[model samples]
Target: MRYIAIDVGSTFLKAAQLDVQYLAITNMESIRMPEPLPNENPLVKEWNAIQLLELMQGLIDRQLASCPGCKGIWISTQMHGFIITDEYGVAVTPYISWQDERGLEYADKLGSSYFSALMERVGEEAWRRTGLWEKPGVAAVGLFHMLQQADSGMEIEWEGQGTACPVSMNDIQTLGSKRLCTLGGYLIQSLTGSHVCHFTNAAPTGLVDVRAGEWDIDIVRAVGCQALQFPRIVVGTDIVGHYHSRWGAIPVYPDIGDHQASVLGSLADATNEAIVNMGTAGWISRVSDAYHIGEWELRPYFEGSYLPTITKLPGGRNMAVLVRFIADVGQSIYGTALTEDTLWERLLAEADRAAQYFKTGKGQSSNGQLHVHVGFYGKQTVADKGAIDNIDSDNLQVGGLFAAAMEEIAAIYERNLYVLATAGEAIEQITFTGGVIMKNAFLRDAIAKAVGIEAVMAPACDEVFHGLLRLALVSEGLYASVHETREVLLQAIL
Candidate 1:
């Protein structure tokens, strides 16, 4: 059987034809994501939800037309994005990207005392119910920001003025615009006319009970949201809807979380394998049969299993930030403007050369080299700020500084892995995924050395899409369960 696997990434919308029986990808295609709307605040980002939905539908339709043997459509999308919709399932606001940081501003205006109290209460309640700690990137924070805007009587407009009128909070409440749907859920709503999300997508929203696999009404109320302010939760393998094609109706499975999907797609034995995927953000996630709330973030896995993930904001984007900063400094010092593309290549080459120096014990001179702290994730407070320390005139060069940044990232991974170790989860192997980590040998080796494990690249780079196919296969009864399908496919490949 052939399954159409679609991955809605932050940068690209990808689709592939997967031969489930042979575990092969016969064909694939990708298109860039719709251009995000510009905003005054550098931290804020939004996408045209309707445009993305229409584009995705077109892609699915084309694939189903070409692949007559396609049995189902499986979607895996980036987690934490959300869009509010009215009774007719039309978007009322722009789709907020996971990288957005308006939540911090909302929390700040609420005052430190009130904000801290609310965060503490919310975090405790969320952790207890959802096995997830309240964090900035979660949708609950975005929802809080929206509610705050609503309380101020601000007009919330969807992308493209005159495309849709600005919606007021009272209007949203009266028009039944309560639920915050994921990009996948929105697609499902557009495709099957249902406003529901899979457990994997809902797990990261800070609203669903991880163990119970249902929306927690208390968390919603604590965030000043109505009980129905979240989508109905379904399992990963549930057939949420069907797409009627010329070939016939293609069964569609509930969308899976990109993080969970990537891990499953990349790791042959997800139960024993740990992965560090570095893209816009980097995360270290390890699967466990039981749910344990540690310092790390927790996400729901297939079959009621849980993963403890440590998400760090300083990933590929941090490298880009450092490169840009160095470029600016160079332009100021030498009166020469360097192209970003050229500077990026130059910085990477320098970083690799300096990493070689560090490996040979040349960069460190007993006092230790500089430490670069990248805090591209959280608030701008000093406590959450980034810094470069212990720098001397000799080591102030790009090579050394970039090398330090790389080491700092690896050190973070090691530290987070130590947390999982302390929690009694033994990771048998470290698998690397994501374009940044997989292609960069210096960073990959640095991570392996820092984590004290041999980092093995996953079998495929597009593991997120692969994971959705696995879910789809299970949904179609090609395998008795996800575990069996994963094991069978892994056994065949390995």
Candidate 2:
């Protein structure tokens, strides 16, 4: 069987074709978005979504035309990129990336009690957890929690759009201007043709009933939308649908955001097992048999079959941030796209960019490197409120400061891993995936030393995609369970 995996990450988007039976990649390519699009451009927003969807279909046609339709085409995308849309699936608002900090007000509304309760059950989301603690680049898991608080009557207000938009984590959805439907479930619909959240997707939405493993009405109202409209939850392995015929009519398998899928694909979502995937971005997650809520956070996710709660580390886009800062040091002699990469040739080119960036910033060495923090998942912030500026040259330094900043990032990972390992109370090996592992030797060595665990890379970079195929084989009943699928994968690929 062949599986086409599309990874829609916070940074670059990628598509791949894998031969599950042979454990081979017949084809793979990174989906490219035209650069220089402004934040609020409607054309940029709507067209990007639609065009990318089409391109994904096209890739399937190109790669699998000879093999007939694939068993499943999986989408492992970024989570909480809350984009509103009309009935036809046209985007109503620009895509709000996982990095956006615009929802801090919602964090304030979550109230001490709710957050306290959540902490006792699960950890807080990354958007603000590190501010109280001071970590960088971690994902903001609290976004869902905060959004929920804003929607509920237990309301509080903070400055937003001049006055405030109401503290409602009940992420609203509309079927055109009719306002006939609304819910946290619209996120996946806006991206794929599907109009539902996956089983794992719901857990992180701060809307799933942790105990019941089902959607919660109260939580749905909190995001300010009806729960019914969201995509119906399905196991990560279930067959969702087939790609529209325009692209190639491949089968579509919607899923838990990329993070959870990575945990499974890497075989890290297991008792005392873990993995850190450092791609164009980075993240950390642990798989337990059941959910455990620690004192400082709420249970972010609870799969019926697994208890895999994750924290987005601060390493992903920061690589690009550093790469640009490095480039700004001098004239990029060759226009080679070396912001971040591991391809032998690409790395050498990026090195030249870094060299130039370093030389130019020598005098302004005090420009000082910036540290990106994480809370498993991070939404980084600084101690001082007014001490911030846009992430251009002023805020992101690259000299002696850069070295200092890298040290801080390394420390943040090591320290947080210690806290989480202790907080969760049981853990062992930490695995790694994504692009960063092969790209940055220094980072790999540093992380290995910091966590005090031997890190293993996915034998194949396309593990996530092939892993999807494994899930399809199970969900489609070709095999009885993940273990059986694993046995075949090990025999064929490993």
Candidate 3:
């Protein structure tokens, strides 16, 4: 059997043709996500809903053409972003991105940000029900921002219209009639007329009672979006609807969260191994058979399991700061425009050389003399800026600098892993995935050494696709359960 797997990622849109019987991805394709629509508020990031849908349709159509007789369509999407749709299932607003930060804007006379106000109203208990932290860019916060604007009689500018009309009070009153759809849910609705959300995807919305497996009405009311419509929550393998395509009607599954999909695809031993995925952003996660909440973020996983995760760590985005600095210096001082690939190659090569030099007891013995904190984008508690400490003349080279940065990131993983360990979820090994860790062998080794454990790369770079493929197989009844499918596939691949 064959299936089409799609990933609506934050930076890119990807699709693949999966041969379930052979456990192979016969073909895969990706395209950069469309540029966000211009907004007056720089913090507000959004995309044209219809345009994004059309782009995805083109990508899926190409995949279907290349691989005929596709039996099903499975999807995984970036979490915490959504669009508001009218009663007829047509989008009324832009597709607000997960990167959107309008929720941080001041919402009222009390000098409270939309996010802060919503957090205060929801309180700790209601917040805990969603298994999420109080943060901006989440769907609930975004909805609250809209609600506050409507309540204040303030016009919410989208796509940069100066004299935009204020969102009417009636719009707020009629919110229950409107549908809140994530990108994946919107796609499913557009393709198969299904209005459903998978638990994995829904958990990040800050509106669901994750343990209860439903939207929390109290939390919804607290956010002043009690009238807003939410989709039906489904489990991992539920078939939401069928997409009628040129090939035929293909079984369509509700989109799961990309993070969950990537971890699932890694084929890590859920009981004894954790997965560290470092892409544009990074996270260290371990699977659990039951729900347990603590300092770490809790997300719903397949087969009623849970994932204890430390998310939003520094990754490629942080690494890019140094890379861009080097590139800028080269262009400004030497008038040389370095290609991105060349820059990365040189950086990694230098980092590798530095590692080898240190291992062999180099001349200066400047080990631990330099440190790079990779928190360019603030961490969970404070908006701490990135810093470099203990830099000396002997260790102030590109190789040393990059190596220190890699070591710092590895240390972060180790520290967070200890958090999981303290919570009684210790792992003996790690399955690493994502572009950053996969491309840099030195970084992977650094992580392994830092964590004091064996580390292995995922069998495939496109872990989300593999994860969706596994889910598809289970949905088709080829596998008795996700756990069984993972064991069988892991053995086959290894």
Candidate 4:
């Protein structure tokens, strides 16, 4: 048997055909996400739900045309984004991108005192169900922003300001209210006509009860949702629906979150290994059944388990800033601009040379003081401009600066890992992924050195794609669970 695994990403919709029995990728393809409307509001980000669904249909058509034996469709989607749909599953509003921040403004409008008081009242209940705090960009906050706008007679625009559509307000306040679901839930409903979501996908929305796999209606009502709708929460292995094509009827599994799917796809053993995915955003996660509520995010994993995750934004974004700085310097000095790739190549070479110089006792090291804090969301400090301290003439070059940045990143990872260790979740092995870490071998070594752990590169494949495939297999009853299939499949591939 075979399966078509799809990853609905923010920038692209990726699809792959895999032979489940042999655990091999037969083919893969990607379609760039449909561009959003140009708007004056930088906070507004929206995508066309109808167009995305059409793209998915086209990709599925192409896959089935070539590989006629595929039996299942499993999806892993970008979480937090949401859409409002009519009863027939047609989109009534544009898909709200997770990047949208109008919800943050709405959150601020609640006033700190009132917000804190409300959190105190609903904090335990919300976290008990959702396994997440009231993050500004999640779906629940977005919904609040939408409903409050409708109530206040403000135009319902994506991310607070854009091209106004009073029609959306009418649909929203219609006598029989429409439904709201995350991007994954929207797709599942569109495809299978089922209002369903997986617990892993629902946990991030700030509306689900993580343990019960159901929406907390009281919390929903508290958010000013008079008649808000939620998809039925399902487990990872349940066959939620089926798609009938000319080839055959293929079972469809509920969608999973890209982060959780990436962890599974990274093939880390849950008992001892922690997965570190470094991309445009960075996340470090480990799986366990025990749910410890803290500053870190607690997400639903497979089989009613939980994953403790620490997310950071300083991965590729910080590296990009450094590369651009070097590129600008080269442009000014050499009278020619350097491309990002070329600058990184030069940076990696320089990093190697600097490492050798330090090894030979000819260069200075930061001694852990020169920290480059990447404050994408003000997690560290809103006013903190990242600094480089204790600099000397011997280590003032770009190579030293770049190396110091890597060390700082490594140090942050080490600190978080140490905290997890204190909490009795000691990481025995580290697996690394992300364009920055995967391309730069020295960065991986630096992380391994700083964290005091041996780091291995994640499988050089689309981890989310493979992760969803394993879930599809489990849904087909080929294995007892996602974790079991993950172990057996990873052992075979590794």
Off by over 4 Å in 2: 33-37, 40-48, 64-66, 85-94, 105-194, 243-250, 295-303, 307-310, 332-403, 423-426, 476-478
The residue-level lDDT of candidate 4 at 89 comes to 80
Using TM-score as the measure, name the better of candidate 1 and candidate 2.
Answer: 1
Query: Compared with the true structure, what per-residue lDDT tens digits does model 4 show for residues 1-494?
Result: 78887888766788898687787776799888888755676666777667777788788778888877777788788887888887888777888876666654534455653334345556665655676645556776666667766776766444322233223565676625577777888877877888988777877877777767778777777676657666787864667887777778777778889998888888887877878778766778888888677656778888767888776446777677777777777788888886778778888888778767777875745452234555534443121356666765456777777776777777777777766554335788899875567887887887788888778988756888778767766766788777688677767777
lDDT of 3 by residue, 1-494 (tens): 78888888878998888888888876788899988887678878888887788888787888888777778788889999987777676777788877888888885564788788888888988898888877897999988888777776766445421122222334554686788888889898888888888888887888999999988999888887767778888875777898888877878878889999999899888888889999988888888887888988889998888888888777888899999999999999999997899989998999888877877767254544578877887543221579988876677789888998998888887888888765445688889999888998988998899888888999777888878778877877887887878877776677
By TM-score, how accurate is candidate 3? 0.94
lDDT of 3: 0.82
lDDT of each: 0.75, 0.49, 0.82, 0.72
Error of 2 at 240 (Å): 3.1
The parts of candidate 3 lying over 4 Å away from their true place are 160-173, 358-368, 380-383
Q: How high a TM-score does candidate 4 get?
A: 0.88
Candidate 3, residue 106: how far the Cα is off, in Å? 2.7
lDDT of 1 by residue, 73-106 (tens): 8888988878887767787777887777666563
Model 2 clash count equals 56
lDDT of 2 by residue, 1-494 (tens): 77766666655566776565665666677766434224452211212333444555565566556556566666666654444445555443334444444333323445543334343334344222221221211122233443354455444322221121222223332222311111223323433456665655545554456456565555344334542244466544555555555545555665555665665577553666556676655555665454455422223332354433334455645555645655554346655443333433453344444435655875233534444432222343211111222244553533333443344456656765665575454667777777766555556656777788877665556555756656666766778876566566655656
Candidate with top lDDT is 3
